[model samples]
Target: MNPMAAMKAYAAVQGGGMPTGGAAPAAAPGFGEMLQNVMGDMTKQTRAAETQMTGAIQGQSNMIDVVTSVSSAEASLETVIAVRDQVIQAYQEIMRMPI
Candidate 1:
């Protein structure tokens, strides 16, 4: 899996369409939009990994491709988990502040 291609796919998904040969959009995405986009990308990567694994099991896909897909999915899940942990920690700190 090419990193550039994966990034491009992410960008396209976040943009809500295929990337055009132009400058970035002017408006910033809302938190909900960003979360939705990230979830969508994660789902795509997970599905790709599953498909690759099934194909490999059937001798239709290369082991390297399956490994790459699985690794990508694992990395994405780790990133999500790290973000969640930070968010939870931040909330805890906020709750601990003198009110």
Candidate 2:
């Protein structure tokens, strides 16, 4: 399945869904700003994960909790980068197209 569809499914599975409506939901607040905010949040989460992992290795935290959080953060960051790359490529391709 496409990435967006997969994301929607994952969100639903994670209980992120709201009720369906007859009309489309309002555009999310901050539209373009939201992307930047998300990227920033992902970076913060990744850093936190790395810190947790380091602490775990140093006997400051439990290994299992560190492993799970780090893996999840890594996966989320990778997904964000992949989506950003796809969007940039699509924009570039569109710009090259003749009117």
Candidate 3:
């Protein structure tokens, strides 16, 4: 998947919608909502990959399709992990801030 398209999809799933010329009126999604969205996306990608692999095993899908799906799922998983790490680091930094 194209990185820009992936980013746009992520933003949309986070309740921000795709960026427009004007600023979006919606408030940013809460941490829980963001986490849920990310998890949901990961689940979808994983399922798709699994389905594609199963089809390939049954000789109903192309090997290239299976490979693409698996790669997309892997990328999605990595993106989630990276985002999770960033969120944790931000929380730790915030906790260390003098109030």
Candidate 4:
């Protein structure tokens, strides 16, 4: 399966659920846990890109692969940051509204 699909599946499993032939309901991760997971994935992708860059520099891998990996990691990191920012902004807006 694609990585995102796999991640969702794993997240569902982690939340004490088994698939019942349909998509699971959203289960928001705690703030700390979400941050931790994002950081972990960022670190992993950064390391992988670094490894690819190192290989390319040493003539052990192709420059195209290194560049692609780096860009993909950068994009993924940006997406995570954007999502976190949006979530924070939403909370702030909710706090400001009269309830």
Candidate 5:
């Protein structure tokens, strides 16, 4: 997945899920599911980029296309890392709160 698509999906998952002030729908996925989806997408993008790189090395894929794919994969990776860091920070903050 491209960075934009990944980011959009992230936003959709993060957006105020419960309609207005009502309870969230039972069909809504939990945080774990959202994180899993992001990780899966990231892995897919990385794999595609790797395949492009391999093709380029074999003189089959265009160098420009390979570069673009690799850059997109890198951006998506950075986005995922940033999200992971945010989640970890949030967890640490919650752990410090008095019960």
Candidate 6:
């Protein structure tokens, strides 16, 4: 079983749809902007992981630090992939609707 399988399942079940109630539009970030921010963070984590691994190789960082950073980056990557897959699935589902 994938480590993120539960998270992915929860995300899929949530549907991530827009709110139907009347709320301040400015209070919430737009979907596109939120996704962009997540992408940026993922990039940063990947870079950080690489740096940690390099430091470990040079004996500047411990194996524990390297392992933790790499694990974090891997989790982020999996999250991004799960989000991408969900978005694609949503798009496909929308396309199948008879309008």
| Best of the candidates, TM-score | 5
Clashing pairs in 3: none
RMSD of each: 6.3, 6.0, 4.5, 5.4, 3.4, 5.9
Cα displacement (Å) at residue 30, model 5:
1.7
Model 5: pairs clashing at backbone N, Cα or C within 3 Å? none
| Reference-based TM-score of each model | 0.72, 0.64, 0.71, 0.64, 0.77, 0.74
Pitting candidate 2 against candidate 5, the one with the higher lDDT is: 5
- Specify the poorest-scoring 10-residue window by lDDT in model 3: 1-10
Q: Identify the superior model by TM-score, candidate 3 or candidate 6.
A: 6
Better of 1 and 4 by TM-score: 1
Candidate 4 per-residue C-alpha lDDT over 23-84 given as tens digits, one digit per residue, 9 for 90 to 100: 88566566577657766777777888999999988999998989988986887688677878
- Tens digits of per-residue lDDT, candidate 2, 1-99, equal 224535644554454346477765544434366466557667776887888988987999888889877876777688678878988999999999999
Q: Evaluate residue 24 in candidate 4 and report its C-alpha lDDT on the 0 to 100 scale.
A: 85
Query: Cα lDDT for residue 73, model 4?
Result: 81
Model 6 regions lying over 4 Å from their true place = 1-26
Model 6 residue 10 lDDT?
A: 49
What are the Cα lDDT values of the candidates? 0.77, 0.69, 0.81, 0.75, 0.81, 0.76
lDDT comparison, 4 vs 6, better candidate: 6
Superposed Cα RMSD, model 6:
5.9
